[model samples]
Target: MSQEVRTVEQQTPSNRESAQRMALRPVFMPPADIYETKDSIVVLTEMPGVSSEGVDISLERRVLTIRGHSASQDHSGYQRVYNEYTDGDYERVFTLSENIDRDRIEATLKDGVLQLVLPKAEAAKARKIELKSS
Candidate 1:
């Protein structure tokens, strides 16, 4: 499928500039799926270990940004065993278009998944024109 959303600038630990500050913990770019319908665009982001309260979303000047923070679990009185999963924060940015209705956009987070609904502006929606017999 064609990808609608794109990252402003993908940053990685190794690829990051030297002047850029480092995060104590790993920061991940949460995977997101973008779908377009007749009325709106839907985005689904997967952020495991993140809760609703940990999600932060902002939009300004047609730029949409999402941040998800997750605290690593502290296993008290437990010894280090096999390790697999790591805790970290999520971040992503998308440049939106003028066709989107900014005021009507909606966002919801549930079960570590974030769903965003970007409604299209009235002028952007498809309409059928009827012809009258002359």
Candidate 2:
């Protein structure tokens, strides 16, 4: 199994009149760690400020994609001060091989971390064959 990160840019309107009115949103690739076990592959990603309802995961044509959205921070009573960290959306994609069992994939999110488990197919598991002596 292999993992790849891609950045997708949205095209603006071709019309010159409409291009000036369009605004482009920034997309970030969150840091992720992948581990391979004897029977499964585990993927963990850090997505701070993202809630469970704001996450979307999908698999298409052997490509697995994860997207996360974080709500804007609320500072209603206090005036604006020095700012350093910018909150944005997260996007990532991974390519899966035939050895993975897509039907049994599982995922969990907790404390701004996302964990995904990709189980290996039954036929893909390693097995030892015994020989019989006549």
Task: Give the top-scoring candidate (lDDT).
Answer: 1
Question: Which residue pairs in candidate 2 collide?
Answer: none
Give the per-residue lDDT of model 1 (tens digit) for 1-134: 22255557556533253114335666778888888887888989999888788888878777788878785676899876877977877878887654688889899888888999999888877778899999
TM-score of each candidate?
A: 0.78, 0.75
lDDT of 1: 0.76
In angstroms, the error of model 2 at 67 is 0.5
Q: What TM value does model 2 have?
A: 0.75
Worst 10 residues of 1 by lDDT: 13-22
Taking the tens digit of each residue's C-alpha lDDT, what string does model 2 give over 1-134?
Answer: 34333333333323343334234334567888887787888889899988999888887766777878777776799876887776767777776654678899999999999999988789877778889998
Q: Give the Å shift of residue 22 in candidate 1.
A: 4.5
Considering only N, C-alpha and C atoms within 3 Å, which residue pairs clash in candidate 1?
Answer: none
lDDT of 1 at 26: 68
How well does candidate 1 match the true structure, expressed as C-alpha RMSD? 4.0
Error of 2 at 30 (Å): 0.6
